[model samples]
Target: MEGVPGSSSEHECDSNSLHSEESKLRLKDAIKHLEQLLLENDLVAPESSGTISHEAMQIGQDLYKSTVEILGSKMFVETEELIMAESDDEEGQFEEIQDDDDSEQYMLPEKDKSMEYIPLDYKIKVVNMAKEHPKWTLKTLHKQGCSRLKSMKHLYRWEEDIKHGGTIIDKYSIINSWTYDRFVEARVNYQQVTTRNLQEWALSAASQFENFPFKASKPWVIKFKKQNRIKQRKITKYVTEKETATLEEILAAADIFRKQTQVLIPNFHKDFIINTDQTGCQYQSTFNRTLSTQRAKAVFVQHKSSNKISHSYTAQYAMTMSGKLLPLVFICLQEATGAFGSKVKKAVDEFVKIYQNVKVTSSKSGKLTTYLYTQFLKEVLSPYVKHEKFLLLIDSWGGQTNPALYDDIFQDDNNVGTCTIKVIPPKCTPLCQPCDVYFYRQVKNLIKRLQNCSFLIEQKREIASREDCIKIHAIVHHQLSAPIFENMLRYAWFASKLTDEREVFMNVNEVCFPLDILKKSCDCKNVTFIRCAHCRANYCFACFYDKYHPSTCTVPSTSTDE
Candidate 1:
């Protein structure tokens, strides 16, 4: 045995070959047993038995071919040799082999697969699916076999982009052209595209395009805050297109007239330009917000009775472009009788004593009639026109724009050769009339404040009498000083587009003499003065009665020592 050591190795090889032949024989016998069991159980139909046998035979042939190819490979032979060597080294050792479960405990876990890039086809599928089932969640899609999009956040962003008219196809994809065009068309047409509409469109697209890879869900749709509704403003007077057009035409004409007047009357002073307008003054206090408990619902406000005859007065005023204010004309509703008339007369006399140009008139209705307007022009306006040429601006009131009134003013013997009358555009008094623009608002505000104070005073005492109303109004009128009037006049002219020289309108603080300046003592020493009723000049009372009382007196004349 020691002489032939190689003979043992040859015997061992023969033994291994014999073991492999026995294992192959056993495998063939097991396969034959499986076929016989299937035939006995009749699991396959008799008609398909031949087909099953043929399939089995074909599978076996494929298996044999793969086995032959693997065994003939160089790598397989090397692997077999390595395994044999390892087995021979362990043959002498007594080792405890592990079971399948014990071996799994020691084995390393399989690594997680990396996130894969989604194809354009898959993205389109997702968008289409989202359109169909807008209410489905990402988890729901995953459960239904849509695993292309991994995260809910990513899915929601994609869904939102599509809803906002984003194209599903990639920018560089060949099929992007059609998708982009469709997206643009949808965006143009769907002005207020809603989540539901987007979802429906996506689902519809998915149906059209076969092989869509993703599913739609509710969790993928973004929510938005609802827009707040705005309240509309209420308009009292509805201005029509025709009225606006007419206003524009009138404005153009007014501009032309202004330029022409400037050229024609080159030396016309701003002081010679005048605007007059009428406003209503109410006896009652205007409603205004007052401090009260936050929760109080019903607040009692004191106001006079709404009697047109006794509660309202028509106030007409004139303002020069140089900011000089003329005396106010109050047209009372009552006739010249009773306590109302007496109080008005007393107030007028007092006002005339203080301001020479003031006048008070009465009418059945508290409005300026043509006759009253003519009286206002004669008494209040005409006295202030010291220039040879003057401009009178008035609104388009029927009484104010009367042809007879215009003729009277121009034909007046006292007027400076030229008296140009310009009627403001209809319904444009607030913007074009200086009195309406500058004076009336301040007058109303002051009047209201005074009225409110009087009302508060009356609350603790007796009701306000007509005399009290008249007194309050007089106080308010007197408080409108020269400087205030001047500022208002400048603002009015500026607003009306009448004057551009701001400096000319400035410095309105110059001393303004009241109409009753002549009523005071004459400048002469040691002489009693009397004012002439016509020329408004102070004279010795005896001399004026003896000389100027019967004739028009031009200058003050003192009595000479007898």
Candidate 2:
């Protein structure tokens, strides 16, 4: 009896091993449910119609399509037969439903929206399982769902997908990744295999550190399983600070003069006013071997130093949120100088070349030509920005943001959604250079640190666009010490704990002002700071300074009033 019990357990284990894949389980579940449904309706059980539908062959076809899609036709043969059988079974049941003259006068699909379009392979799997699982009873069906995903990785990915749409046929599945694809290499642009024996016969090992304390290549660590290992590898070519002339470097250091100008000037809102400025991170990278080093501390130091590029061009938009001048929106961009609309059809085509040829991360630069400056606000940032009075803080260099651009972007009539922008008034920086004060110092530190680390290079060769390079930085950035990375995000955003309590913005007009602001700022106190001479609304002091009034409007009268 004891031996018999053990033998039964073995049989059960064997059964499960044979049908562990998700497709197989789904098929089993479908058939079990069908049988129950038929019993409830008191329908005659087809002696031959095992769990599949013969009446609606189309349903079976659909299942076959799903099966071929989920498991692949080449990989899942048995799944195909089950789907075909279900199609035949559906045919009979469907006919009976159609024969009922008193039935509801509408044709209905087999499944509702809750039950969605499954790929061909998955559909086939369900069909086959049902065909084979006649005697198997479904004790319960527990559909596990999830929400409130907090991982920064997931949040960023969702935002990126929303902005770019997708490659080839546009489907919402890419937008909706309910089924997570955690493939190790899905996001990486390039990879290389290794020859180490310990690495070869890999077993998952307890990491000496929970997070790698440095920024470097992905394969962040060689996460080896008992039989396999995973290591993140990053390959960014470090820009060696080759003996830059201290005087020239001081000249290269754009932040110094901006700071001095800020203190000398009062109302000191921000610094470095340019007629126009470039966007996007300044320092970019390519492949590097610096990461292959086994020491954790060394990698961390190397990464912190060399990545001295800024995240975006500082566009100063004085936003009226609660009557406050908030510096918002870092317009990081790639110059559109090389792209012409008539020659190429899309902004994407112009960007595609840079995607491969240059380091494509949010932070970038390789021999700075024209200083790029456009906020790289993708899906993640857009919605939040759209919600509040979103403003971009930048130097005066970015040609005054066109009023038409503002009208086109911020007005509901334009359907550009809705936003508020106020270009920070020119000649203010000591107290309010969004990132100028905080971010510059941080990048300078990182640049200096990486400069000292010994770089392991295959050889000195420059390549444009290195997506893999950025991937590595992101991975290492995650592993590095918290103080370091938080600073990185801060520098990227050009935000600080401090912003002016009172800034002059051209209050947006809804019928007169945006609804959210209507509630938030008391409609700019019903008494606005500056009024537009051209329009009825309050003059967005910052915006008018940049776009509408730069060339023609009267200069802002200086007043010490808070």
- Candidate with the greatest lDDT versus the true structure: 1
Question: Per-residue lDDT tens digits of candidate 1, residues 1-562?
Answer: 3543232333332334434776557546655544543443344343444454756767665755543433323113210021111012222212223334543243222331222244444444465444445555554455444565544345544443333223333321322232232333334333333344333333322322223332223322221111111122354656456444443455466566556545643466777777778876554545345779989999875444545213455777677777776656454444433224565667756744544334666666556788778888777776667334677787777777765666556544564346777777664453455565445656665555444443245444322344444554444454453342465457656645466433222111111122233345554431433333223345543343223232343442332210
Candidate 2 Cα RMSD after full superposition onto the native fold (Å): 25.1
**Per-model TM-score versus the true fold:** 0.42, 0.24
Query: Ten-residue segment with the worst summed lDDT in candidate 1?
Result: 78-87
Backbone clash count for every predicted candidate, in the order shown: 9, 108
Off by over 4 Å in 2: 1-337, 340-381, 398-400, 411-418, 447-452, 455-562
* Per-residue lDDT of candidate 2, residues 1-562 (tens digit): 2532122332232233345678567757666655543443345354655554555566665654554343432233331122221111122111111223423343333332122223332222222222223222221000111112211122233232222222111221221121111122122213233322122111111011112122111121232221233443565643335422232232223345334433433432232111112222323332232445566655432233243323222222222212221222222233345323453335434443433212221223221222222232332234334533333444544443454544443434346544333343333221234444223333323322222212222223221122322322222222221221332333222222132222111111211222222232213243222333223234332343223232343433332111
For model 1 the local lDDT of residue 497 reads 49
